[model samples]
Target chain A: MMNKKTAPVGVFDSGVGGLTVAREISRQLPDENIVYFGDTARVPYGSKSQNTIIRFSEQIIRFLKTKEVKAIVIACNTASALALDAVKDEFDIPILGVVIPGARAAVEATKNRKVGVVGTEATVQSGMYTKVIQGMNPEITVIEKACPLFVPLVEEGFKEHQVTEEVIEYYLESMRSTDIDAMILGCTHYPLLRSKIRAYMGDKIQIVNPAYETAMDLKCLLEENDMANDGTEGQHSNYSFYVSDAAEKFRKFANTVMPFDVPITNVVNIEGY
Target chain B: MMNKKTAPVGVFDSGVGGLTVAREISRQLPDENIVYFGDTARVPYGSKSQNTIIRFSEQIIRFLKTKEVKAIVIACNTASALALDAVKDEFDIPILGVVIPGARAAVEATKNRKVGVVGTEATVQSGMYTKVIQGMNPEITVIEKACPLFVPLVEEGFKEHQVTEEVIEYYLESMRSTDIDAMILGCTHYPLLRSKIRAYMGDKIQIVNPAYETAMDLKCLLEENDMANDGTEGQHSNYSFYVSDAAEKFRKFANTVMPFDVPITNVVNIEGY
Candidate 1:
């Protein structure tokens, strides 16, 4: 039998983008430990094929398995959208994906039932959000746009930069006329540039962050499954972070995006798995 | 003895950026056959480690060797900068890199002996251009800047877009003070943004494209080694193209970057090599 009370929850993204997810999880469940893996070497999973994405996801999962995680969260939207269903049954532990939580959030937040989704090409093309949202509310309309350059813009540390604003406008210009009440930041990287996205979309539209909802969903799952860590509320725990390549750069980027400093980040060879 | 007169020449890049190189080679050596490989799966080699770049370059070379190429041209600036010297002696056939030709062109074009170089992080960090140029002219001043976002901008087809101009200005701002008489477009993808780059740098500072010089060097090397494809000038040769992932997308991007259509691009498992 596996010990669930103290085992860390595993969270992974293609790269630093997923730090937003890990940060949310840390804020929502302070006592619980988190093991975050960023595949920086073969990043931008948005452009890779489903098979390749699944293979890369499986390798990351296999590596996470070594950490004895109580649950695994697919923080990267492209991986969750294209790969989760294929590997969900293979693992004995709980497997959570961001798309369902994100979709649910959008469905709940959108009063007009008109929603826009912006993500990587792979995520939008997967039709996962549309399928999930439509399944929940039969009449809700979904407009999905693949903003490929957004990831690069965010990765290049251009959150509030004018160039990033220009790119956001370029990708989202048509969506302004669509009159969507709510928009989903479907890609993990998109949350980092939320201010610019919101500025471009106007104040009337609501922005949904999958990371926050995913963390909440994980917390609910932990309680329902009786797998919640039983430690005191203020229990101190060390969060372990790992990346496929360039730990130093990942750390610096994490510190820039998050409120706290990333003290120790390790580099691991993900291909071996 | 190798039958060089009828064999194809090999060219490899990290992704579609190298198509610019292949196109240049076609313009310079129309009768010669070409074999191009784009490692789209592991692209943006600008940030990868030297060891990984060399490993990837060697695998690509091995795959290209299977095509029976008489010579190999590393069209990618990062690969040519970090991996060439390590693999130059491993192969018996003629091996050439873009860095040398680009450096030579910069040295020849700069009247004030002051030159500026712009490329990917890995290529610029490698100091290959600075070393080669300084070796040629010890008194020449070389300033190198790594414009990391340039590739993604070009890949997104933002040649004349406002964002592209902002990013170009953002990257080249500091170099305005260097008073360099000439600037080298060290990365293959850069030539696509020549108009924007030239406009920003002003007409006085000459822009040097390594692709032209690299193609010319390849031509010279072929004739010097008696390996020139000496069949009739109108001899036909199929230009084969391969990528590690997304053949269809690569073909589309090729058409956007190059003047002609890429009829059929094949996908290969570069890791297996």
Candidate 2:
């Protein structure tokens, strides 16, 4: 069973935004190999419906399964919000999504009853945050905003721009009007636009990022499953990134976002998947 | 061959941004039925590489060809820049990309012999504008900048925000330093942010939109080939939209941008193509 510990973790996202989650997972697990698939060809799954996102998630999981992953991480919030259960049902291996872990982290971090969620349109539409937060603490009030541009802006490398700041302000105006004490960066891409979002929300609003929590959860899962990699100090761990289209761009994005460089390859044409 | 004019003119893009192009095509050719495919599933193709964009363009063309389109319009700037030749070569039918039409228009519009091109990274990096312009008039100076964030900001509906404007200002600052008499909004998504771009460049700079030029080109091509739609006067032209994923979002975008409402279907998986 322990041999499975080193079997490698399979993580997939619509595009490079999942690198945030991958970075966290790498930080927490350190020793295990990670096989990351960014469906660059068919990215931005956030605006897609539950049915389409679910179908895409199934195909991605199936593709990842071929890589012999012991567990699957649905690093996309939109996918997790709409398709986690569908994926979990379809796959025998343990699966984790950014939503539940993020929701749980938000619940733990929020001192006031009021909490806000900002993500892509699909995430906001699903009311996943309200459902998950209400399930955890029935009396807590949840406010959600669909900042549809955040993902695209981040992917386009608009990390800190005046226009990005203004867009964030416009999108967050409703959330700011509320008495929310904490906000969840519901989408992975949202974190890349952190300075703008935080500036808009101000210091009082505790921002919850699921990437960190998901990483922690992944560590727990590996330990529980006896899938922890062999302990050796300063051992090199391998990471391979696969994007459905635009491997060159994904490689450039990897250099821009992550601290350590990981090689990116284009193998899948996810249009059919 | 006149019977060929009865067939629909097919247009495809990464997302709803293509609606700008489609709307123009519709306005110019009221008699023509338009079949549009928005690859909303994997959008923002601006930052990808030449090879991936080429592959995507070919796949989209293959799908459109199945509908028996008389002509195909690549409404996307990145795809046009990177894959126009490949697409034209792959299909036996007449194919038109926005670049040549836009380039021709920019050449005509420019009086100072200095032209600027603003688009996605992929479009800019391909240096398509330089090549196309040089091919026409070697004396025409070309300046290009990759306004990567523009597409996301527009899709997010922050076209007129202070922050978005500021980001535009930052991206266009270098262009402003040059003596560009005319600027080509190379990416379809850029037109959505045209007002802001115009504001930054001031009134002196003429903006050449390829979509508009493409519409004119399509009209001319139909007239030349005698394949123009000959539907009865006052008949409503219909458009059918298909996407690899996110039919609903495509519908939302179409409703927002197109002159007429579009019914969307997610019919083909691109991987198989």
Candidate 3:
């Protein structure tokens, strides 16, 4: 049997947006086991209140702890902005949020030192990006736009719809005026709207998606902590999913978002935990 | 004090979209008190799975029951489509789902017996409109397009932007080909987009909003059941709000949508109750 040190890394989001991060993690760390939980039942945490999002995050982290995860990744941007600080205090394990990773990446990607951000209203209003960016590079100027509709558009599978394009155009119009060289997709779901947003914003604006960068950061954290899975020949890593509500939709969404299929289960009642 | 029977009616939606319905209810029954709950914590129920939406609806209804609501109105179209039956069975009070009321209105409003419908994916997929409209008038031809982005746009408060107009044009273009005589704003948030929709669909297409009709229905039900708040001299009614998430955002949204301000409170952890 493989050593217990190869315990799975737990990741969770309000819905499928986390899959973007999960997929990146899977690709970058093929040897490590991954466990994902999508709160498909009660999604769109972006619009929810700080306290409510914190409570929900606590429940999800507690459930993940039961699985003995080595570390946790708050793949949802809303959770990252509102709940990450409180979560780090309550839990002993190391937790990584998508914001800083994306922020750092945006800093590196921007040539003009002027950046734009698009996320859910809560995330945008929290000024998380502005604070994070300015903390690292005080010279950089940040403009933030809340593309609240992007999440719903993505969830409804309007990935390529013309209306989606128009909506993205509407949301990005504010950014275009700022002459931003890079735009950080502050919401996990915003990445799905990449092509549409890019088409409207044109090729000049470099879009920074945190999911990929977060995956890289997770790998670095694992190696630095000596928690990376050891080579166990003939053993393949698998992913299991748990959702607060509606396992079936989570399963279907899992198939749609990620390249590989994973087993998804519905807990229905998270408060029970 | 007025008799306890004149207690405020409880209304809820996944988010601020229900404000449209709430506004109508307040306008029609000026003297009646209202208690509104916007599950701003986990909004955009249209994209979630049926079972998860049911759970959310159940939790919101349970919360409303604690308020001792005289009647419950689900001002959200997604809940009306997916959770209405389950909610009706779970609670004994006069529970009204917006689907039937809206469908009935659409059937009545169409001059050419040709109607178009636009809403979230779940609302359109549920076929609730087809079933309800056919039951009312079998000969009426219903053309449905799931304009999923509309909810987020309304929530984001982009009701009158150029991009909003573009999005409306893109979404309503489908209705133009069908020559729809009436277009039902299937989602509660949709009525907020009525001006844009009306502009796109032109004067020939009658716009049907269930929020308006539902308010009317509530008045009739209250009067018939002898639960109407007496509008006699020296009578004043008040409203209290409970949201699953941000009290601040809900308060701001309430002020914008309601004719007058009402008190709002955040119920921190009411899920699964």
TM-scores of all predicted structures? 0.93, 0.91, 0.89
Candidate 2 residues A21-130, lDDT tens each?
Answer: 99898888889889999987667788777877888888888888877898999999999899998889877999999888888888888888888999889999999989
Whose TM-score is higher: candidate 1's or candidate 3's? 1
lDDT of 2 by residue, B216-241 (tens): 99999999998887785456766788
User: What overall lDDT goes with each candidate model?
Assistant: 0.89, 0.83, 0.83
- Indicate the docking level reached by candidate 1: medium
Q: After aligning candidate 1 to the native by TM-score, how far in Å is the CA of A211 from where it should be?
A: 0.8
What candidate 2 gets wrong by more than 4 Å, as runs, is A193-202, A230-236, A255-266, A271-273, B231-238, B256-271
Candidate 3 overall Cα lDDT vs. reference? Answer: 0.83
Give the 10-residue window scoring lowest on summed lDDT in candidate 1 chain A. A229-238
User: Candidate 1 lDDT, tens digit per residue, B1-273?
Assistant: 556788999999999888888888898888788998999888878987787788888889999999999999999999999999999988877899999999999999999999999999988888999999999999999999999899888876687788888888899999977799899998888998999999899999999999999999999999998888866656676688899888998888888766666779998988678
Worst 10 residues of 3 chain A by lDDT: A264-273
Task: Give RMSD (Å) of candidate 2 vs. truth.
Answer: 2.9
Over 4 Å off, model 3: A1-3, A107-117, A137-143, A156-183, A193-207, A264-268, B1-4, B264-268
What are the per-residue Cα lDDT tens digits for candidate 1 across A68-153? 99999999999999999987977777999999999999999999999999999889888999999999998999999999998887
Candidate 3 chain B weakest ten by summed lDDT:
B262-271
Model with the higher TM-score, candidate 1 or 2: 1
